[model samples]
Target: MSRKVIGIVMNGVTGRMGYRQHLVRSILAIREQGGLPLADGRTLWPEPILVGRNAHKLKEIAEQHGLEHWTTSLDEALAHPLAEIYFDAQVTTAREHAIRAAIAAGKHVYTEKPTAETLDSALELARLARDAGVCNGAVQDKLFLPGLLKLKRLVDSGFFGRILSVRGEFGYWVFEGDWQAAQRPSWNYRTQDGGGMILDMFPHWRYVLDNLIAPVQSVYAHTATHIPERVDEQGRTYPATADDAAYGIFELAGGVTAQINSSWAVRVDRDELVEFQIDGTHGSAVAGLRNCRFQHRAATPKPVWNPDLPATESFRSQWQQVPDNGEFDNGFKVQWELFLHHVASGTAYHWDLLEGAKGVQLAELGLRSAAEGRRLDVPELTL
Candidate 1:
């Protein structure tokens, strides 16, 4: 069988999402599996060179993974003739510069969401990638989650006839560091560091709504900094300037209404850390990170509302579980494989830098809506 080795420059993977999801879970997993198979009787193997500012950490990670390349000099990595793709999972604030450098170096670009801190910059990056004639992509990992995949299947199969509304609940209690230690990085609590619920998550909501249900036409949102202060990783306290919670209402194309609540201060009461419930005229389904449950219109139970009486019906069990018809791979890994195929074989990929810019646009609009306390129409973005 023919084989192609594609060298990738992996940056900012020393961070949480970068380290776990992109580097270890995705690229490394792909390498472990003997690379991705192709339609033309060929296998595309990835040769990833870890790039980060921390020399010691990079060396440690490379050694741990039995990887041969790790470097502190991004320019040096970019200069490598074998490196054709530059992947960034850096902090949101640092993404634009690194990506621009990679593009200038004529490398295909792929990165984690919210392509840039602002919509303008995000658009500029998209323009640059197109001008340079390089294949580019942005991470929309949520689309590949098993639950969301099943939800998409149901939607495609017309099970949810005339989808009416969608409700998304995301987040869980994040430790304040003073007591149990904060679960997230301290940079996430500082706005200057590109930390905030609206900026971080609205991009995700944008893509999810646009692809799964419908394109978001408008947004009305309320955002808050519920926790004003938190302890840092170094055992120091700092003011939390970013919004810890965001409650948003999105109007989608085809008149579907979607409401989503994202908060780090809230406690979890659902089956997963994130869940989406879609209601339609014919059926209703709730999908979590890994599972989906549904109740058809014919099977939905009717109960009389009695505030004075204790309800004895098993409401939770009334919905039937959506069976797992096939084994699912890690979401991040799946996207990586698709991207590799796109790079190797010129396959059609919909999630480009322009799509990433759309996500940034939504976040910007959401913040504006929250600040003005009004609904805002989302203008269509074009190349």
Candidate 2:
């Protein structure tokens, strides 16, 4: 079978997510699998070149990963004849400049979410890519998760009829970088670095809602930086300028109210990175990042929600762990292969750049709402 050589110019490959998720797992894993099969009996694998500002880090990563090509100069790498795709996982604040350069180089572009920090910048990038006639996309990894897949199945099967609402609990206690290693990048705690819970994650909910439940039509949000002070990698305390916690209420077209509580301040008291409760008239379902369970009205114990109830285990047992049914892969990696398949074959990927922009749009509106202290209308966009 013929194979398309897809050379990927990857910027910020030395960063945690850039190296781990995009480089080693997505790109190298595709090479390890002998490329993804196309619809027309063809195959495609990313010939990835690591690009970053840190020479030592880039060299070490490439050496450890058995990738021969690495470059500190992004311009030089972009000039390579074989580089058809340019990817960026740089810091959120720096993403636009790199992606804009890639678009100028006539390469198809993909990057991690919050396409740009501002709505206008994101929309402008979309316009540039569209005018250039090149494909572009951003990472919306959660929609491809296994647990979400199960949740999607339950929702599609009418298990959650007359869906009432969805409540999301996400985050664990992040390290303060004083004694223990910080769980996230230091920039995430600073607003100047394009860091904040709302900007970082509202996009995930946008696509998840748009695809699975309802398109977000309006938003009312509140945000805060609970920990006013944070210790950096050098153990120097800095004033936290970003909102580490976000509370958002979204109104969908279907009247399915969705509430999200995102944080970097809370300690985990649950079994998952994200837990969702979806209650419907016919039944209700709860799903996490790893497991899914449900309860139907048939299984209910026939008790009304009371103000003075102590405890009950009847409805609890009805919710059981979803069985393992198929081979599982990293959510981001799965989406990457889907993108390759769509590019090499007639098959198409469900998530695209426009969908990615929709996510960013939600975040943008969310910020506006938080700032103005009022609900904001999300203007619809066209492809």
Candidate 3:
């Protein structure tokens, strides 16, 4: 089999998501497996050049991985002719400028969600990439999760006859950083740093709802700063200027309604950190990050509301667990493989920069709906 090496310039490799998901689990894992094998007996090996502001950290990561390339200068890395792909997992506020530069430098760009801080900037990036005729993509990793994949299978198989509504609960109690250090970055609570539940999570919900359920037509949302204060990384206290929680109601194209509650202040009481309960006319299903459960009309028990008598029916026990029929890879890694294939073989990839812009548009409108105390229409972004 013929082998080809694809040089990828990966920025923000020191960040949590970047380091863990994109670099270690995805790219490094692929390298360890001898790269991705194409259908035509060709292998595409990924050679990543770690880039960041901290030279010491970058050097450490490169040395640990036995990778020869590491650089503190982004421009110098981008100028490398072999580095055809530029991947970003940086802070949301810094994404636009870096991506624009990558596109201008004639490199394929792929990045994490909320491609830009605002819809306009996100759209500009999309247009710029299109004008430059470069292949670009954004991370929509949740779609490949095991639970969501099962949910999609059910939807595709018509398990839920005449789908009605979807409810999503996503969050875990983030430590206040007073006694224990916060699990999330301090910037996640500061508005100036492109922090807030709406900006951070709405993009995810937008893609999820649009792809799995239906196209979102409008949204009504309410946001709050449940925890007003938190300590920073250096044990310094600061006011939490961004919304810690958001409750939103979305109207889908086919009269389907979706309610999603995203919060960092809420404690976990469910099966996973994130779960979606979908109810329909014929059946109902609840999907977590790794598992999914379903109850059809034939198996659903009749339970009458009773205030005086003790309830005998076990509602949770009624739903049957969906069995895993196939091996599942890491969600991030699956997308990475697909992106690599697209770059190597000109494969068809639907998730482009325009789709990323739609995510930003939904976030911008969701925040607007929260501030205005009204349901705001989501207009289609055409370009």
Candidate 1, after superposition: displacement of residue 363 in Å? 0.6
Model 1 lDDT on a 0 to 1 scale: 0.94
| Cand. 3 Cα-lDDT | 0.94
User: Relative to the unseen true structure, what is the C-alpha lDDT of residue 112 in candidate 1, on a scale of 0 to 100?
Assistant: 94
State the number of backbone clashes in model 2. 0
Worst 10 residues of 1 by lDDT: 27-36
Per-residue alpha-carbon lDDT of candidate 3 for residues 290-380, written as tens digits (9 for 90 to 100): 9999999999898999999999988899999999999999999999999999988899998899999999998999889999999999998
Total clashing residue pairs per candidate?
A: 1, 0, 0
Per-residue lDDT over 1-383 for candidate 1, one digit per residue giving the tens place of the 0 to 100 score? 97888899999988999999998899889888988999898988899888999999999999988999879999999998789999998899989999999999999999998899999999999999999999999999999999999999899999989999999999999998998988899888899999999999999999999999999999999999999999999999999999999999999999999999999999999999999999999999999999999999999999999999999999999999888899999999998888888988889999999999999999999999999999999999987
Off by over 4 Å in 3: none
lDDT of 2: 0.84
Per-residue alpha-carbon lDDT of candidate 2 for residues 333-377, written as tens digits (9 for 90 to 100): 998887666555536555666777787899888988999999998
RMSD of 2: 1.7
